[model samples]
Target: MAETTNDTATLDCLIAGGGYVGLSVAVAVKHAAPHMNVLVVDAAPEDALSTDERASAIAAAASRMLGQLGLWEDMLKEAQPINEMIVTDSRTTDPVRPVFLTFGDVNEESNEPFAHMVPNKVLVGALRGKAKEVGVTILHGETVDDFITSDPTSEITLGSGKKLRTRLLIAADGVRSSLRDKAGIRTVHWDYDQMGLVTTVSHERPHHGRAEEHFLPGGPFATLPLPDKDGKHRSSLVWTEPTANAKRLMEAGDFTFELELESRFGHKLGEISVAGPRKAFPLGLTLARDFIRHRFALVGDAAHGIHPIAGQGLNLGFKDAAALAQTIVEADRLGLDIGMETVLERYQLWRRFDTVQMGLVTDMLNRLFSNDITPLRMVRSFGLGLVDRMPGIKKMFIDQAAGRAGTNPALLNGEAI
Candidate 1:
């Protein structure tokens, strides 16, 4: 573990959980206000990024934010732009999966693809490099065990018994945030009774930057395109199923699991083979009751955990980072305490409506599509067809998904905060 002796100096911000969101916050703040002292403490080992095999869909807005942080040029080398998206609704055993909705280079004027699929390692490494270059300290294999928010600062105690002081503490510790609970922040949470199974798959034919989402009775089985390797086509698959079924598939022998996967994945990609380890994560919706308290604030999954039906989880977290960083940078420039409730409230107010709307949309989509009820299926199929037929409406939906709708922070607009 990286160790720092107990210090009397107070930092501008101390962020917990050095995942993408936390790291982005550190880098964003430092990029905006170079004089601020920012530190990121995470419980994972220093080499954790090297072992992360997952891939995240980076929205257009997030891609812009990465560019502003000077990481996009390097990330683009490993990023696969999502040039097209097809949505289909059908049963797992259906003979044909008909596409009901489609988005293809939907925003031609901007020339920006709706999103990109980048390996987790590539993005994290870039963010870590930027953070290091900007003098943001990152302490690995350490966690904040306790903290007390008082007058002008918050005192944090690490698991190793070392203590530090900071003007504000940001919790990016994920869905089950310890710091959030410690700060007496309550959440509205409920399980979706579903699990998302993720893995990489290599196929005979290329995906051609086309992503597909098959809305099955169990849940949405998403096939997101990824860059190829050694002449082999590749894609990331997120297969959602009931908790029991997901466990069964995970424990199934490779051959057996592949057989089941082929049924849902179809033969369009040609012969497919699993490329990496398969992992399953529970699906749920968790929203923190309040985004800030005293000198503490929550960001990323620490603030909201929504259904992944829309693949907007990481994007939402990035929005939080951008909003919070902008709020702090602006407050500091005004010679005001960055941690004050007034400053924090602006961040909360900026993000709350969007967060709530996304939560409800995902929840409704999951419930409406994750079942085989005949009447409901007909209704949803009609809804999908209706949306597909309306060009203007479809464009609006595509723009919204690209994170171009509503008020955006300067960072999200590819501007320095």
Candidate 2:
């Protein structure tokens, strides 16, 4: 029930949901095609983006993309390089956990670490600043209530009664995207019956930029490095467990919670204590059936939501932003209709397979590790051990984690569209 208005000037691209993915799209598009008029709308208040305490792993290729957009320098100050990573498989109460696989500190050719850990606020704030500096119109505390797509243009109505006309409408509104739903885009979705417990921990010993992932009976438990806060060594922990157990842990007393954490985390980092408030997020896999429909396209979690066992969720979203921006900018530069079916189809073809592959891999990893079946556990452990014994296989995995194994778009490779 949108009030159609042709009086308003038409936008080149109208993006819904101004999170990291949405803002990155705005920055990438405007930076590439300065003449294109772009507008970003978010349902949350202006300060909401900077309020998140979570941190994420940024693969090297994604770091390059941020650098190209002039964000990496500012974010670099707060980023913690992940110099090494180790993987182990063990039961929750095991007195000793032996590492079955490990990745070294640097890429063979460039000597660059494969990834870095950065606080969510630092990255979001940097993108937001860049978006505004490039003249991308931002409508905070506003939501796209409805939109109608026609041959030449799409008209969107906001919650505040403002109407906008745009040639393309991009939905980056997360997994349960309202704009995506309104466009009649269907998704293949399912719950993992698990939840991820996230919080920071301060330790007596330095992590030295090393990350560890332990495959436990419940799920994968990761301890990712973070820059020390207030002179204390810190690490961000992603602990996955059964949904019921996750809830119980969240509600448990601090002492009880610490004991359970100590059992999985071990004593490698010396004494450890939870440094902040703990939060739990339900796990799931969701992939949209179609990435593009008419003048509307999906990006980020709106298009796909995968299990986070591989820590590639944010990186995948960044890939979507880069690819979509490149597709749109190239089409506009060629004097073609950017929202045409052919133009959008190219983007769908470029990204869909990689997204599906990652989704399947993460889903399989979660399934393979989140249990205690003796035979299956033995098989996976043997596989891990075999991979560790082969340097070539280890290098391949490091490259994959660095995001260098795929068919990447120019923007992701740090080039202009």
Candidate 3:
């Protein structure tokens, strides 16, 4: 099925879903509306190979929204830059073993590297080669099984029967968003009997860019740092368990699942070896109660999915495509109606309080570490050893996990319009 129709021109936006939050909200809405036109669509299954088999954790506010969409300098040479994040509690044997969080200097005033673990097809191939060098068309096997709109545009059709007329409609379609249930929107979602499995590993010692997280009572495993094609070190796990123990560790026996993922990433990589191929996903907490209606608008996971424990699911969809591309580039430079509802209610009032406070802090960190609770495991492990002996609250929790604390929306502070 290959469909491409472009005759009745006069479109300005249409993006449905080309993955990675619909090709980074169609190149952040054509880099803040570069003469409109943006298209983007994706149904996949046409020998699909624009890559991405899952591996997302960008964060430093999506690496400053990929350095303000310039595509983070060629995805930082196959990315690895975590620059620190530790977090272990390694499931109760408790003899004072609690370092519940660490996050050291990611980017605190130019000493960069707060996050970057690329490979969502190399950051969607550097945002589809910068949306085809600023043109941003991208069709990809077509989709959108139905649609209709007017009062400034939108008219689609195509489950492979080409047809579309648009003015605006952006549903970075995903997490069960068939154009948000064909624009009738309604979602509350649930299902976190846990799953996140992910893969990649091969260590002889070296994950020095650092990122760990252990927790385990059957959830929150983490293990990041990656870059090694026989370069002597690597990692990229994620692990979160309990879904019948991640389906019995992906049906075991790859040497008993690399000796149980080298026993929880062999305590900071003295071992580990399964370099790829192992997946699983199904940890939820959807939320689309209503992102926006009329001319459509609902970015990433089609408006919320939360809980990668704190990899902030695609940095909350690049802070919802950098606050809906800075509220439709300052309401289309004053002409407003960038898909109205007063410009998508300023991206639902700038992302409904950081998506309900990061979904109630990753659902209270997955119900306080998936329980083995002995008084909330001793009050969050003595409140993480009292914020690790308070070094100004551990540098404000490593500057809010290096996304550099809230109220940031200039492409998450990498800046550019």
Candidate that scores best on TM-score: 1
Q: What is the C-alpha local distance difference test score of candidate 1? A: 0.92
- What would the per-residue lDDT of candidate 2 be over residues 99-182, giving only the tens digit for each residue? 898888446677778999999989888888999899888888889999999979998898888788889999999999999899
State candidate 2's TM-score: 0.97
Question: Among all windows of ten consecutive residues in candidate 1, which has the lowest summed lDDT?
Answer: 1-10
lDDT of 1 by residue, 1-417 (tens): 123546575789999989999999999999888899999988999898787777899999999999999999899998999999999999988898889999975676788899999999999899989999998988899999999888789899988888889999999999999899998999899998899999999999989999999999999999999998778899999999999999999999999999999999999979999998999999999999899988889999999999888999999999999999999999999998988898899999999889988998999999999999999999999999999999999988888788888889999999988
Considering summed lDDT, which 10 consecutive residues are worst modelled in model 3?
Answer: 1-10
**Model 1 spans with C-alpha error above 4 angstroms:** 1-5
Candidate 3 per-residue C-alpha lDDT over 261-284 given as tens digits, one digit per residue, 9 for 90 to 100:
766665545656776789888888
What is the lDDT of every predicted structure here? 0.92, 0.90, 0.75
Off by over 4 Å in 3: 1-9, 12-19, 24-117, 133-150, 154-166, 171-213, 216-221, 229-232, 236-268, 271-286, 310-365, 368-372, 375-417
Instruction: Assess every candidate by TM-score.
Output: 0.98, 0.97, 0.34
